[model samples]
Target chain A: MSAPGGVLVIAQAEGGALSELSREMLALARRLADETGGMVEAVLLGENLGDSAGDLIAFGADRIHIGDGAAYTAYLAEAWMPKLIEVAADAPPAVILIGHDTMGADLAPRLAIRLGTTVATACVEAEFVAGRLHATRSCYGGAARETLSFKTGPCVLTIKSKSQAALDRNNGRKGEIVPLAADAVQTRVRIVERNVSAAAGVRLETAAVVVAGGRGLNGPEGFKVARELADLLGGALGASRVACDLEWCPASIQIGLSGRTVAPELYLALGISGASQHMAGCGGAKTIVAINNDPTAQIFKSSRFGIVGDCQEILPPLIDALRVLRDAKDS
Target chain B: MHIAVCVKQIQDPEMPTALLRVDADTNKMMLTSSVSPVISPFDEQAVEAALRIRDALGEARITVLTLGAEPARQVLKAALSLGADEGVLLSDPAFQDPDSYTTALALSAAIGKLGDVDLVLTGRQAADFDAGVVGCGIAELLDIPAITFARDISVDGGTIRVQRVIENGHEIVEVASPALVTISHEIGAPRKASLRETMRAARKPIAVWSVEDLALEAAQTGALGARRVLEALYIPSRDIECEFQQGASAREMAQNLARRLYQANIL
Candidate 1:
């Protein structure tokens, strides 16, 4: 086998467009490849990758490998892994990057085992030094960060969402497009049902502004105020792990170490003490505004602005004030 | 039916950040008395998942396996108290501080030693290291299929059905027997051990296995076998100075905060 050199990103598509995380991986791959002196390549796998190959090149991919078929749309490690190995046979990549989403959490480790290697999972930072990958990941429920380096090359990594910036599209750049057949592999796993419980308003993972509530809300009714605030701001509603555990909110919207990770431009944390675990999910927000009655809460330390008061008392007036501002801007 | 559930005992993840102390020299958290050890929350849920299956079947044997130090037996005992039929403690000096790869190797070896395990279950990830790889690694080593991030699970004849959590929603997946499933926090809280069961668990004899017992090489079972090298571990220091929104009353403070956000262009 040839020695691994370039970086490979496994691109994912949602609603017929390249997923935000797929683009983020391309951005990171570009930076890493530029620094390490290797080509930036991507593998697009789906039923109909239509124009995604061109998009991949525009996003800094030097080459795009397409695996188009019905089997590629829904990810089952059994079917996708062999296809990936077959695609990489032409030019093996030193590092394979996947977004640390549901598919990644299932695929990376198994793929590493198949390749007789190891994976650095959910990495927030990574760089190539001395021909090896050094990755930094959070552990101890996000209370601490651990930096690790692989002993050998040809490793896999699942990058945390929103951890890196996507480069601006440059249509003028040129790249190669290679198509590969979807090999037949017997897969034991079958997706019997796919449920998309549609929620109103913006999606939490990509929302620019996020409004999160915690146990300090006193009861489930508190979420009514939070939902109204989120809808008024055209944002999304989120909850801490405790609130979800207490059944005050659906677990689908929980934001914490064990839950969803959201990186918004502005994060308003209401009635939350900001445990390290909870902060892990939203620490990437550009601006954090915290409101808790406890002046010394941990959230205050991470917040750019804090208000020490009861959320119940502050939220109503805050909503009114936001309404006034929105009306003024509209006029 | 024979089921094997893997569990781990670690410092309570819910402990306050002030109590979390890291030893720079060792690259490990300082295990102070203030922070008590408990079963990793998700692993406890895994145990619950196994018990739920056993309850539905009316006749099934569940075995709890844990690879850690002697004290790690507490997690096994906790599982036994929750109605696991047996407990196996995989412990050895060589097993100390193993990475995810070595840990998976040792656990899979132990499972092989069990001779007949129709199904395997584990938490999505341990709260401490959060590597989230052992379950899949075990599946690979055993040459079986794995469905991860399972929020719900049920069995029919020789097939296992799992409701897996995806990005926007959930997907129901089905695989044949001898497969593995990693339980997520969405599985709901685990049941508490009763006082009588706890007493019984205290008296239950747990089988202990060493590296040699599992036929694993000393060089391939612990830190010596770890494929990943830890360069550093530390808490990220935060120095953001928070400016408090001030006003004469709650309503006024809300208004001022709104105006401040607008001025800062954050709204």
Candidate 2:
């Protein structure tokens, strides 16, 4: 069979709205499809995720593949990989785009291994040149960027979150949904239970605003200020790896090369020194405000606006001001 | 229980490097003579996880393995200091700069050389490159079940119950023994090295194995045998310019920021 002149965007059901990264992929894929005269195809994997199909179509997907089963209710490599391989074999998309989130992080490499293709992760930008996919990624903790070209087949790339803007949806568009058989393959690993932290609010990946604390917060108690600010802003809370390492914040809230990558409209860095690892994770933020006593702190290099003062003195007043503004708007 | 942990030696990332050179022809990063190497951070987590498991199981034995230059023995020593029963170094000039796939094959061969191993443990990803592919690649090569980004793991009735970190949450997975697990830093905080343990590790013999000893062909590993090639490397230029917001009072700076946010329609 001839190769499918389309891009396959893997979507998750739980992370609804096609996710910012998937939307960004669609935007990039749409450009690729326009150039290649191919269609943009989306693959949605989850249990009972049919509700999300319409959004994918609106975002420029010409065809959608839905693989729904209890096995996919949570991510299981044993289950997800086989289904994805089947879809890829049947469709034979020239390129497969995945998010840089944890699922994409695990699935992309495994899928590339199984499909015998080359895969690139944490891609800041990607384009098709001379029929080959070239992806640019941050290396050495965002201190460097390298453009990599794949000479292999079925090029798979995971775009870093917030690297590309999500395409504006065309409201009335609809696409084809092809359902796959999930029970055909036996899974070696069985997910017996799922424990999601109830305290985790407004997932950092999807949040529009994020308030992050660092080691400058001093201790675990200092995180409350960042948390309160996030809560007031109706956003999520984040921490530098140091804060997490100090046990001041949970690992889930950590943002860095080893933690979550967030692309928020506003990122308030409270006392973060902005190490390369930490900067790489938040480079996507549209606006960064750094609060630190050290004027020479590296965080200022990446921040659009910086405050040279202790977060302890700066945060409470900012939080109060935001609270006033919010209350004024509410009233 | 027999647990095999894979470790790697890498240049300390947090250290300030004055200069680094890449061979124009070979595309290899050359560290300055002043540069010092330490155990890869993720590998430290792997060692800690193995040690914890050994302590919990009581009868378990932990063996640490690595492949690199002679100085790579430092990683094995660190592992030994952390309470590993033995250390094995697969040091050979040819193993340098192997792609993830080739490295996986070589490690799999080394594991095969080690005889009956019940569980293979490795860090989710090495600090260098951060490809996060080796453990999974090894599992693929061995055709064994592998779990990546394991935050918590327990041995229950001969089955490995692992908590795998997903995008927004975690899932509890149960797989039979002889499976491979790649642990994340979330597994647990690493233990501190003590003076006594450091002295003990100095005397702990590290068995060295080469490609010839493992019966692996030189053509099977390293850059020549690798599937992927780094076409180019360059430093990323920072676009945002830093302007020091110096003011007499913290409130004054906040006022300026609030005005800027308002001007930017962000307030």
Candidate 3:
């Protein structure tokens, strides 16, 4: 099979095209296309995604393949994988990139299976060399890095969350929006209900500010301070897996190798000791601040700034100060 | 009830770092030959869930299947010692490095060869790659219902009740039998194999099958059958500066740290 002359950016529209990660992927795809002399095709799979194509075009997509349907909305793997396969087959792209979310992790491997190619997940970077695609990814609990390459076509790679900077829009560029037929994929595993986390306030991936709790929170009640800070900042609340496993917070709020990865503008680590597994998930954040009573905590090693104090006493005053600062700015 | 749990032999991720080799070319870590291979952590949970279902149903049979090199027998023995009634090892050079889709198809073939099975269980994701797709892929191939990331499983009547762990929370789902489930660590810790049971497992017979015996298509069972291609792999550099504070007076040091905390706007 001949390699396609374009790159396909698979967009998981959980947060719509305005999502920072989608914009980042679009920017990365644009760079890859410019280097390889290929067009950047953004494939948006979601219900009611026709309205989002213009937004994608502004971000540098040369073509858009919209797989819009009810089934595409909630990310049913059996339904979405086949659609991706069909899109790749119809207009085979040299490479296919996806966001490293739950849907991407599930779909990439299945798509690789159907296409007989290599698929790398949670990739932090990629490039083309000698007609081969090379990607850098963290494996083995983030202990090491490995550069993998494909010997075949339609290489599938999922970019880790918050690793790339969002691309600035082109303002007036427009792309061709091609509606692709949704392949018939019969799945017995139906998603009957999707209950979003109401307590977490905002989705971790898209949040601009994130307030994370850790073992120092002591217990569930200790998380209230972190939650208050998140609410005050209009950010998302996150926790270490230990906190989640201990039932101090919902698993969705956990930020680690087994939990969600966030790349917020400001990440507040409260009582987090910063284990490697936990650090791997948050390395993409622009700036990190650590507050822990233990001055020797490992989190200070990763934070741009560090504070040695009890989060309990420190968080309340910090929240008050933020409130005053914001009120002053608004006034 | 007849349940089949697919397991894999994996390097112990928690092993001490001094015993592993880093692949110079790919920068991937290679387990030292001296390190022992164990059943994947998640797969052990799957086996435990299968045993629970068997105990609940009064009369049930459990079969464990693994597809890998011949050395995978060690893992099969471990599974048998953990109460699996029978074991099947699908060994062939073609089975090596087959991506998730091919592995699923090959495992499904092995299951079909086992005759009638009511439930199939596997780990949510392998520890090595952490790609949680096999159970769902097998479900797609068999056209059966599948619940991924299941923390709890039960059999009631002709249906299976499972608690699925999602991002923020969990859902209690009830599906009909002949379903597939991928168990997670949250399900329950796997029971240890007693010395007596381990010795007994050594005497137990393990059935071996080849790719030809399962009748899997050559095109459907290798890297050529993979749909996704890896573009590249590279290790990320860590910028960590370990800072240590040494002092004798606890109160004095605490006050000094407090001043530093205030300066950093943490207090």
TM-score comparison, 1 vs 2, better candidate: 1
Query: All candidates' TM-scores?
Result: 0.96, 0.91, 0.83
Model 3: residue B147 alpha-carbon error in angstroms: 4.0
Please identify model 2 stretches exceeding 4 Å from their true place: A1-5, A15-17, A35-39, A171-174, A198-201, A232-234, A320-331, B17-26, B202-205
Q: What pairs collide in candidate 2?
A: none
Worst 10 residues of 1 chain B by lDDT: B196-205
lDDT of 3: 0.75
Question: Sorted by DockQ, highest first, which candidate order results?
Answer: 1, 2, 3
Candidate closest to the true structure, highest TM-score: 1
DockQ values per model: 0.78, 0.52, 0.29
- C-alpha lDDT of residue A10 in model 2: 89
lDDT of 2 by residue, A1-331 (tens): 2234778888765544456667788888887777667788888877766567888888888998887777677777777887788788887888889988778877787788788765777888887667666788876666666677765667788888778878888978878988777564587777788878765688788899999999889887789888888888889999998888788988778898878888899999998998888888998888898989888787887888888888888777777666766676689
Model 1 earns a TM-score of 0.96
Q: Which residue pairs does candidate 1 place in steric collision?
A: none
Model 1 stretches with alpha carbons more than 4 Å out:
A1-4, A329-331
